[model samples]
Target: EVMKQPGTNVIEVADAVLAVLPDLQAQLPPSVHLVIKDDNSVNIRKAFGDIRVTMLVTLVLVVGVIYLFLHNASATLIPALALPFSILGAFTVMRVMHYSLNNLSMMALILSVGFVVDDAIVMLENTVRHMEAGESPLEATLNGSREIAFTIVTMTVSLAAVFIPILFMGGILGRLFREFAVTIVSTVLISGVVSITLTPMLCSRFLRVVHAKKGLAGFMDRSFDRLRSGYGRSLRLVLRHRLAMLAVFVGVLYATVKMFGIVPKGFIPNSDNDSLRVQLRAAQGTSYYEMVGYTQRIADLIKQNPDVDSQMANTGGGSGNQNTGRFAIQLTPRATRALTAQQIAQQLRGPLGRFPGFRAFVNVPAALQIGGFRGNSSFNLTVQSLNYDELYAWAPRLEQAIAELPEVEDVSNDMELKSPRVNLIVDRDGGRTWPPQKCQALEGRALRVA
Candidate 1:
């Protein structure tokens, strides 16, 4: 029976292997070992709960700051309430416009904090001013509303108008900034309405009667007196030699322009953080093990001084990545060391030069704000023309030119071209059957792509 079996296939391999390690063995010594595998999947519900807890804690902390800054709980509550109204309203607009709750949206929200408060601030300050000047709360509220009603309308309209044009912007830039503009415009519009309506109600109901303190008045009066005197002297000097001052100011302005030009015009400025990401890309088809090795080398270089508290690497590829390798590397803070993020990024880039295909991203936050892929630095070069041939020919030359630029990274033709292929020819008259068109079609189809 064993001779009838073909090679190992002819033999009962299961029986042969079982002879080495049998489960019901009366004939073998027991051997034990452990098998290992990786599974990163986890419970999603638990993750959502954790995120909620973190958000609650952060919100509570920020609310505490707001109260402290305003020095009044009611005042803080009134404005803080507006934050949600403004944010929610802004988010609603983004949703309607099919924008995501991404970095740009968050950035616009941060900016709105300062701006949304503007109308509210003016309303509250005006009411307070009227009250301080001896008017009743009712009178102060009505007069304040009347005073800035037109101003608020025009301002809100103007703000909204600014964003309306952005929706018409021609490229990805327009699409990216669209959310920023829309969010700001929407939140500002909502805040403006709240300022005119809700703010007046709160001013009347919540604001405490604050009389000018004698001590505070005396101190402010003295400070202003000195300021007035200084200003009066400066004004007199300028008036006395107006032409000389004008000439001097003009010369200074000219010098300032010259100085501005002297300062080298650089690309994006360094972004701040307690973290820096060093992205590594090796030649196509580099193995994960090789990438891990390179990452370790880069991490070791970073770990040398112990300033980096933590380091991790995640490897992946672009959408159409063939052989090109990619990595998302992170460096974190040390408990003992206090250093600016830009400084740390600079250090990482210095050592990363040893690994040729490495690019360091300092501002992870800013990259997101501009609506680009997270940590993606390379921008597209769009060369539109009536002729496709001219474009195809010029793209490589342009890519070469861009590659020569020290400031640019990942200089590419913005087009994908396949490697050349071999061809076999046959004459149909020599009793050969062939479809050259079909073969050519197959050739195009056979191009191996990622």
Candidate 2:
């Protein structure tokens, strides 16, 4: 019944609510029942599943590709081990920093998988090359790591430097990107540490001396050698024809810059969260039942949508405004539905748009509903003047102008001043003469009617 405060954890709130459910139910009459439903837990579980699945798929692919190239189980295992150690270490750092493993952070972790394994792969390959050149395992490990240590450190620092600025960005965007950027930087640094230390140690302990290869392993080795030679030849050719290469590079860069204007731009991308809200506002003088009727019609039409899982409506005193009500439509989970919450809201708009004597808006809630950015609608316009008469006079005309724009929909104004009210004034002498019981009775009746 109450809107959650900004930045409050929905899951924790739901848990606190459930913890006191037994006492609440006991205090209520037998005919009354409390049913608690929430999507936070479902959302959390889905986020975890998505992160797990994405990491697992990346792990499998990386392992497969490594095994295919190396053809040695021990060599592949060395680099693969970096994945778990780097991720676990990043998680530990995140705990220390009080970061939650939400969707954005998890995505950052997934992306870091590619970068994390790079240092390990480079060190392992270099060490293997030393071993193939007839050095002892310990000597190969030491020499190989020593040679690549600076390179790995530089790469890690460079990657971290790219994201560090994002942490200092201002406002909501800064908050959102800070977690993602820091997570990547932390994971990459951890991966670099594990690469130079654990990776070489494991290679020295478990890696075997290379022997003459045949079949698929030999073919892969020869193919890689050919690719390396070809790349070297191409590099030489490009260096020899510097002028032609420069022209081609400049032309490609210019084309890419020109294409930037064709890309769609927005502050934030739309997310499919499987929930929609419908705000209903009746005419200023509309009664509570009349508003309830309008809300019911809208809810009924929304229920007809196959993607809708459940819905709740509020009217009368529960609604925020006297002539306003709200409907919360919970759609089926994203996996079970093809349409996004925004699309479903658009579909329901047709029915709600036809409702008589009511203005309704259907929208998905914002990811973070901060001050002046409720996300209930696309845009908000405020008309302020020192004189109430001038403000009210111009507000409707402005609202109508905005509503007439081709891109605007569900336009509404909260400036209506025509609501009917009855003010009761009791004469001091008349009330002094009235009996206490009569005054009490009148007050009780007014309260009941209200």
Candidate 3:
């Protein structure tokens, strides 16, 4: 059965037992890769099949890169062979320690790619050199590998030691990044093992002396000789003209300092993508209806036609009465969506100029991600002051001062002002417990301000 709906092809799974064949029986169209895996209850095995595909793609890509550079099939195969063992070791350790394969864990594997392959290449190159020389295959493999074993171990331990600080670092961010650190160190150590043992074994079985092109090899040797001679001559010239070189060096250093002084200094560097994060900070006691109206007016332009996939506008003060709300919007997928996420954000920002008594901020993803991170960052300001009134009045002025600068944008003031709210009154004698008195006056400038 087939139904071509551009992004969907209906599969007739009639009378088929999912338990018998847990994977998709029909080939999926490439146009719809992001299949909705909502039926986790029926048979979640389909999810693992997707995971397997992801892992296989990772393996193949790594293998291809190795094969391209090293010019040896065995060099590629060694890591590919050892990766499963490495993953098994990693997974077993994680399982014992109760770690799940999620964003941070998967992030670790991605970060491990460079380090994991480094050790393998080093060991293989060393072993290949021995084979090319007069040494017999087994003798060269053993002795050549032994010479590099200490170096490999030292390098691995050194890399692992650097990661220790990240593990010991305090805070929620540290905890999250710790997973990435663990992944890197684990994969490096595993690669060292594969390098010393499995790499040499593979080299003993498969690596051979390949013929170097005569013109290229000759040019390389001559280039090295020239480079060596050039370095010696340059070093002699520098030593002979030490005083002049020192004067020039000091002048250069001073110029660098001057250049640095002129360079703009700030808390964080600006980013390339122009993602305008238009956040609304309304006055106190603002109704949920008011909030929803503002959000809907803003989101109305977003949700029309075809660009938006889904948007979640939190339409009330959270249960905490924080009087704040947020939205997480996902644009339509890459293949169809014409506008970049930033472009959509800019579209929202442009309409905001038409509104009054509201503040909107244009920000980059870097600014949003790092600023929104669970830390005491983003809106950091320092002011030398004595009085609370001074703080309230001067803060907005300071914000204005900063906002007026070409570099600064979307400045805001905190809770110095508020919206008027309904106040319940009760007087038991007149069917209420209280009355407006001079001590607690409920009229005019004072009550309205409060």
For all predicted structures, in order, the TM-scores are 0.52, 0.83, 0.59
Give the top-scoring candidate (TM-score): 2
The global Cα lDDT (0 to 1) of model 2 is 0.84
Q: Which ten residues in a row have the lowest lDDT in candidate 1?
A: 34-43
Could you say which candidate leads in lDDT? Answer: 2
lDDT per residue as tens, model 2, 1-450: 545676787677767777898998999999999875445566767767878899789889988999998899999899999999999999998999989888889899989998998999999989988998999999999999999999999998898888899989989899889989889999999999999899999999999855888999999989999999999999999999999999999999999998898887877667766788887877777898888788778777888899998888887655267788877778888888888888888888887888779778888876555675343375566677999788978888898998899987878787768854567675898788898888888884544223
Error in Å for residue 91 of model 3? 2.4
What does the lDDT come to for candidate 3?
A: 0.63
lDDT string, candidate 1, 1-450, tens digits: 123243343124534643554443544445744211111112122334545565466556656765554455666676666667777888788888877554566666666666676677677767777888888888988998799878877877787787788867867678668778888788889988887888889888887654543564456657768999999999999999999999999999999999999998744554443455555655655566776676677667766745555555555544424323333333343334676665665565555665665443332333223443433343555687888689778888987987899976544442544444456564658633556776676564654433
- Find the number of clashing residue pairs for candidate 2: 0
Model 1 residue runs over 4 Å out of place are: 1-81, 92-100, 214-423, 430-450
Candidate 2 Cα misplacement greater than 4 A, ranges: 2-9, 19-30, 317-319, 372-405, 417-450
Worst 10 residues of 2 by lDDT: 367-376
lDDT for each residue of candidate 3 in 1-450, tens digit (9 for 90 to 100): 222343331222322333333355345555644333122122223334555567667777888877655555665676567677677767776777676675466657655666777777778778778877877667778978888999989988998888878987777668677876777677778877887888788778776665463554456657768999999999999999999999999999999999999988864354323122345555567677777777777667556736666655665755323344455455554446677665675666666657764444433344324432321113546665778678778887887887798954455555444554566674547635555574266445443424
Task: For residue 218, give model 2's deviation from the true position in Å.
Answer: 1.8
The lDDT for every candidate, in the order shown, is 0.62, 0.84, 0.63
